[model samples]
Structure formats: structure tokens, C-alpha cells
Target: MELTYLRTFREVAKWGSFTKAAETLGYAQSSITTQIQKLEEAYGAVLLERYGRKMVLTMAGEALLQYANYICRLHDESKEVVAKQSKGTLSIGTIETLASFYLPAYLQAYRKAYPDVNVAIQPGNEPFIIDAVKEGALDIGIILDPPFSDPELDCSILREEPLVIIVSPDHPLAGQGEIGVEDLENESLILTEDGCTYRAMLLKVLKSNQVTFKLSYEFGSLEAIKQCVTYGLGIALLPRIAVTEEVMAGKLAAIPFIHPECKFYTQLICAKKKWKSKAYVGFLELLSGGAREGDSDAGSELSK
Candidate 1:
């Protein structure tokens, strides 16, 4: 009935081998056997059965596994709540675009408001970043839409940025103020990898329009793509926010798609049962307000 026994049982159930579980839990094989034996003795039931050199769970073990997971989750949640009350540091993950364009302002404002709170930011693409959050490696994440859907995670739309087709200044399409999907038929396209949310949206739009273009290059780095486009390697479709500096410098031109301008939503996601730390709460407020200000700026720019 000890929690240590439950932990051992959970590890055994996960690996389905006493030796493997022992290795994973960093315990001697005899110690793992003893813990399981103690657990079975306490419950007055045989929890595992031998089958072809492997241990399979008995009905009692299976039931205990379920409850063990719940108990562990509850324990972690309780610890997190206590840590937040004590003003512990917060870890956040975000994709590269927001990290580059928005995070500095948000972090600046957050630090100004909560100077004593420690904050850590991890940046990666959506898949890697979301996985970190899902594994409890981060308390919250700001990432592009098409969020990882898990019952334990909650996602809220924070901001929507329009997608634009961009070309180098010297490209044939650069002078066009606005272009339609049909115009890209024979063009060479520079694209992000398949994991990118905005790239997936662009693919869907192309497929729906029956448009065909040569995908000349694919990259994970937005900066690389921008540099390639700057050299007139190929045209790229990117989020408007990602190209602001390039456009301003006249190195690239953003041409809106005439129909159904793709809107990419940035979302704030967190574990459903996570305790909101002071640092996390302050950072979220900064992000929300910054997003609103960004939208207002974009609106005013469009009017001009």
C-alpha cells in the first residue's frame, strides 16, 4: 500500500518485464521483485502471470495500473500547485516565429511587472515544442494553430495573422500588388517542411484550387527560406509577421492572395490541470495585450 510499491508496480506494468522495469527504475532485479511481492501481499492477490518469458498483467494488476496513473497524476498536480504558491520559476515553449517577432516585447513587459519571477523560454517548431509541453517539460506554449489535441491540454486562439505570398524584388511577380492562386501555376516555390502549420494550409489551398507549382526547395528555417527568396531562388508563402522587415527593406514584396487570404491563428496552449504560476500568468497577459496591439498596428497599416 506504500506509494513506492505503487510506483514499482506502474513501472512493471509499463515495461511488462521485471528486469526491464528494474533497469528503468534504476533498481536491482531482486528489489523490484520484492516491491511487487510486497504489493501483491498487501492486496492479497497475484498481480502478474508468466507467459513465454514475459510478465502479463493479471486483472488485478490491470486495475491497479489505471489507479496508479491517476494517483501519480494527482501527486504531480499537487506538487505543481504548491510550487506555484511558493513562486517557483516557469518554463514556456513557443515556435520560432513568435519567438522572433513577439516574445521580446512580451518578456520585457512581463519582467517589468514581475521582476522577482524567474522565466525560461524554449523555442522550436510546433511538433517539438508541443511535445515538450505535453510531457510536462513546459508549463505553457505559444504556437501556431492546429494544436496537438490531448484531453489534458487546452488551447485558446491568441491571435490571427494573415498569410501572404512573398517574392524577391527582382522576381517577375514582385511588382504585382495582389495575386491569385492561379498565378502560381508554373512558379518555383520555396516551402517550409510538412510539419509547419502554415505550410500545410498553403498545401490545402493549392490542392483545392488544382494549382500546380514546382516546389524547388524545402527548409525548416524561416530565415533560410527568406534568404533564398532574397537571392531570387523561388517565391515563398509566409505569415505576414515573418516578412515585415524584408518587405520594409524592399528586399521582398508581399502580395496578398485575392481570394480567401489564409489566416494563421497563433494559440496559447497549456496543460489542462496545470497550476498557473505568477510568471506564467504575467507572461500570458503580456502576450494577449501585445497581440491586440499588433493587430491594431496591422489594421492601421492596411488603412494607409
Candidate 2:
């Protein structure tokens, strides 16, 4: 059977939707259908069945998927090993805050080191990123969350990320030496989207303390939350890295808010069995060691 057909089959099985697989693989819906048809023909079995709105794999399809995963991975590995080439695609899954604030320098360094290697960054929530990494859809997953581990992943804590409460410079609590959950009582809070880890931590802290707070604004964009805070619409909790420049510019003030329960870190995760292509290893080194090999200054500032 063709490797491309197996890959298409895997993608279709991964999402359980032909349309979604087509989108992810950048193929027309009809192309995805044709590829699956060819794969089923090659195997001489009905590989997929429609149930309600989803495309579900049949017993034979499930068996084929297992071999496809191994075969596809080994095929890629063999190409790299035989060619010894640095040119390949690397897919990374990350959260918005890290993608916007933290990853630029490292990505730049990686690009410089491996100009021929294509890199794709997909922004997603932590759970989604983790799942993509586990499914071999993404080569790496970066997230800001509490210490995390999975038996199937090689997890590393890249750095401690401080979660800070931000407000307009003139807000009443802006000048406080320290602020706690009780300080936010009855105060309006601007929050990020529901799946954000820090947002969950803030909600838990508030509810656990029985602090009555109003959610004045809820946004999916970090910049939107920052803008709302700057206009004094309400206070917001976010990673210090996300607002460092604004705080330094006096556009926003970071209240001295520290809660043990609210601690988060920049984490790097990858599947334990993932093949380490040259580009993949270079990027991983850049993330974990703060610099790619032979480049001393790249990403050094981020380490500090």
C-alpha cells in the first residue's frame, strides 16, 4: 500500500471526520474520500463506516491504524537516517500566551539553524496540545501550566512562569505591596477563555476563598484582556511574561499577587517514542537548553 494513503487513513481516523482530516492535511474533501477508498480497496475491507455525523473506523480499520502508525513513523525515520538531511517539517502545538510572548526568539534561532526545515505552529489549549503530541500529530507541545506528566511523554519544566494580576496603573490596588484573594472581593475581573490554566486557577482561588467577584469581560485573546485591563475595565490574571513590556511602560501595573496554588510553569512535552529528526532535536535543544548547538546567545535572554 502507498504511504500517503496510510497517512490519509490515519488522519481520517484521528479526527473521525473526513472534512476535518481534509482540512488538516490540506486536501480537498473529495481527495480525502478518494484516498480512503483506495486504502480500503488495497486492504480489501470496509475500513470506515458512517455513524450519525462521524466517520468511525471498522474492526479492520482499527487493526490497520495500529500498523499505519508504526509504518508511517518508521518510514519518516528511515528517510532521515538514510538521507541524513536537515530538511523536513516540524509541527509544534502551543498555547497563545507562549506563542505570542515566549517562543519567538527560540523559533527564530531554530529557523536560522535549519533554514530548510519547515515549521508549523498550531495554537491550542494545553489539553488539545497534549493530545496532539500524544497522537503524533504534533512533534512538540508547549504550555503554561502546573507541573505535568504523562507516562507516554517526555515532560520537562522549561521555566517557572509567574502569574500576576494586572490592572491599570491608577487602579486602587495597583500600588499595593501585596494582594491576595480577599483583596479582589466584589471587584470586576477580566478573564481569558475557559480552557486557560491560569484562568482556571484564578477561578478556583476565588471560589475556594468565597470571594464574590464579577466577571466584567471574558476574552479569548490575550491582547484583548490586556487592553481591557489597561482601560481599567477590570483586573486580569495573566502570565508576567505576557505583560512585561506593558508593565515596564507604565501602561499596566502588576500587583504583588502570589498564591502557591496559582503557580504555573512553561513546560515542554513530546512523545517518548517520537523520532528525533535533525530539526526536531535542534528545536528541542533550543527549548530545553535555551540555545541551539553552537549558538551561544540565541534565546539566552529567555533563560534569564
Candidate 3:
């Protein structure tokens, strides 16, 4: 009967971990367990069963999930109507690369324009970001090109650029006007985490070109990757947008990596069924419209 119980059940079922669901919902682990117990008590049926490290839903739980989804969606839509007309909170998910170097200006401008609508952001990798958007946990998402298509989502390409190889100004590769994929063989590389889309593509290209490589470091943060490359720790391949400021500052040099398969794109994605609050619409307008009014200087710098 309680919508809170259904929301907690949905999260726990999706993640299959009480601890993870608790952290995401800002509840204690015990609270999640208690909510689940309450749901089972109210339904008069066994719902969740544990099998080793995994949680498996019983038949009754599976049947209830269908109704729970409908209930939660209606619950959200009802709240949307009761909140200030056309105003509510919007949560956006993105990768660290964009958050740290790219979206700060646009987000700040959005806050100024929509004072009544609170905006928040959560960061994760590409796939995680997309999954959050699909589940309605996030209202919008910015991510790399999704690996596949789904009818439940809508997405658009916001920007596209060549993937570039970057290194310290004094590094040997920095002098080359452009580097072939083979030239990177045996080079120490700094890259994002192992499963990142760009990192995986880079390694695949190297493998196809018969280049053996070693990872000097693997980082989850773009800033850390830049710091390592700035000191000659290792070279990296990243989207030009992520490293433009450092490249301009002469802290690092960006060179075209000539491979037929190397390209990067930033995509804006949203669930087809998500409620579009005025805040969400206004923020997208500012972001896709061009740099904000006062961002002329920053925009001009990045245009190079």
C-alpha cells in the first residue's frame, strides 16, 4: 500500500544488493531490508530469496514487479502535477570528463535561469549513465554513443570530434605531426578504466594494427589522466573536448591519431516516457543553443 515500499523494492530488485540500493536511495541498509519485509508482510507472500551472492525474486515478487512499476510511474506523475506548475527537480547523469571540463558553464547558466527548479547531477561511466536514464533514476543523461538501440529511449548526437593522442610537450611523440596506430606499439599508455568505450576501442585498434601495449595507469577521472600525462608519466588518447584547455595551456600537446576507426561523440539521451519539466526543457535549450551569453570568451577558447 505504501509507495515508499514499492520504490525501495524496485531499487533493490534492479541492483540486487541491499547495500547498493540503500546508498542510492539515501537510506540505511537496515531500512531497505525493513521496507522489503513490510512489502512481503502486506502481500502475504514470499518475495525475495537469496541464492549465494545474488538475490532472486520468487514468482510472487516477479508478478508484483509489473504492478510496482506501474504504481511508481503513476506516483511520480501525480507528484509532478502537485508540485509548482511546470517546476520540479531535475537530475542529470554524466561522465566525469564532461562534468569536470565541459558542462560547468552550461549548468551554472541553467541554475540562474531556472531558480525555482532544483537541478542536481550524478556521475558515472557511459553504460551506467545510460542505464540510469532508462530506469528513470536520472531525468537526462550525457554519454558516449550508446552501444545499441532501444525503442524506450531517444538520443541525439551533440558533438563529434576525432580522438586525439596527447602527451607532454617534451615527449618524443609530441613532435610528430600525426602518429599512425603502429607507432604506439610498446608505448606506455594512460587510459580510462578497462571497460570504458574509448579505452576498449583504442586497445582494439592497437591489436588490429599489431601493436603490443602496456597500461602505465588506469584512471576513472579525466583530471588524473591529464596530470599523469603532463609530467611525462604516460601518453593518452582522449576526446579533444576533454583536454582542450590543457592542450591550449601548453601543459600537453594533442596530435591527430590517424586511424580510420578512431572517432569520439558526445550524445544526449533521455527516456521516451520521462516527464519533461520546464526546467529540463530550459536547460537543454541553453546547452544546445550555443554557449551562454557571457560564455563568449570560454566558447571562443574551446572553438580552437
> TM-score: which candidate is best?
2
For candidate 1, what is the TM-score?
Answer: 0.64
lDDT of 1 by residue, 1-304 (tens): 6788898898888788999999998999999999999999988999998899889999998888898899988988888765654356778888777787756656665666666667787877788777788788988888876433667688877777667889988788888878888899989999988778878877787889899989999997889999999998899988788899889999899988665636567888888777776567666666666666676463343233
All predictions: root-mean-square deviation over Cα?
16.5, 17.6, 18.5
What would the TM-scores of all predictions be?
0.64, 0.70, 0.66
The C-alpha lDDT values of all candidates are 0.80, 0.87, 0.81
Clashes within 3 Å, all models in order: 0, 0, 0
The sequence of per-residue lDDT tens digits that candidate 3 reaches over residues 1-304 is 7889999999988988898999999999999999999999999998899989877789999999999999999988977755533457888898777776568767666656766677788988888888899999998888764243568888766666467899999988999989889889889999898658888888888888788888899998888999999999999988777888898899999998887666666677899998776667776776666433333364444343
The C-alpha stretches of model 3 lying farther than 4 A from their native spots are 1-87, 146-148, 291-304
Scored by Cα lDDT, where does model 2 land? 0.87
Off by over 4 Å in 2: 1-84, 291-304
Candidate 2's residue-wise lDDT over 1-304, tens digit each? 7799999999999999999999999999999999999988888999999999999999999999999999999998978754654677899899998898788888777777788888899999988999999999999999888999999999998887777889899999998977899999999999999888888989998999999999898999999999989998999998887898998998999975778787688889999998786668778877877723223353556444
Question: Candidate 1 or 3, higher lDDT?
Answer: 3
How many collisions between residues are there in candidate 2?
0
